[model samples]
Target: MSRPDPVFPFFLDHPARVTSDRLELLTALVNGPRFDPMFRGDLLVVPPDHPVYRWQCRVGGCERPGQHHVELCFQQDREWAEARASGGNQAEFLEAATRRQHAGWSRFPA
Candidate 1:
């Protein structure tokens, strides 16, 4: 018989591969989608009906109602950090971090 996927059939069926920042964002949105109606590009359209919008896949192809499909959110933040590391402060760092966190969820891998 053929072998199954290495990471499958474990305690967790399918674990998400989002970065630290993305996970933070998702946690915030999942907890309270009303906080940011238009986060990044994906709409936090969490109606009063369904509340638990867990991310199923990492390809962002699934028709899920949330932005949990994305896996990475580092490129933008890295760029921003590099460009402003000279004298940027906490606000700049936060802005870049936020942008990257959401951008990773919306932007497709290229």
Candidate 2:
């Protein structure tokens, strides 16, 4: 039996672009707003079809399928409860995720 190529197209499609250092930043924010103090313990889920879809383009080929990702929204929280109770859309509490690189292109420039 032959081993498969180490770098598969799918795996390369959305390689972990966020740097290890920035991972602390991204995960802290994404995991939950309480994880960080910027958004009042709110959680924003970027829809699978959010406009920032290109951020996940690993090869810059823009060939990945849409089903790969999903948008998440702040589903539960004290503020969310209050706002929803008052009939308000909490769009302002959401943010798009940014990609970062620790080693950067210099380490693997194409």
The lDDT, on a scale of 0 to 1, for candidate 2 is 0.40
TM-score of each: 0.20, 0.17
Residues 84-104, candidate 1, lDDT per residue (tens digit)? 777776455544443313333
Off by over 4 Å in 1: 1-72, 93-110
Q: Which parts of model 2 are misplaced by more than 4 Å?
A: 1-76, 93-110
Best by lDDT: 1
lDDT of 2 by residue, 62-82 (tens): 222222342222222334456
Please report, as a residue range, the 10-residue window in candidate 2 with the lowest summed lDDT: 58-67
Q: Which residue pairs show collisions in model 2?
A: 34-41, 45-72, 46-71, 46-72, 47-71, 48-70, 48-71
lDDT comparing candidate 1 with the true structure: 0.43
Question: Could you give me the TM-score of model 1 versus the true structure?
Answer: 0.20
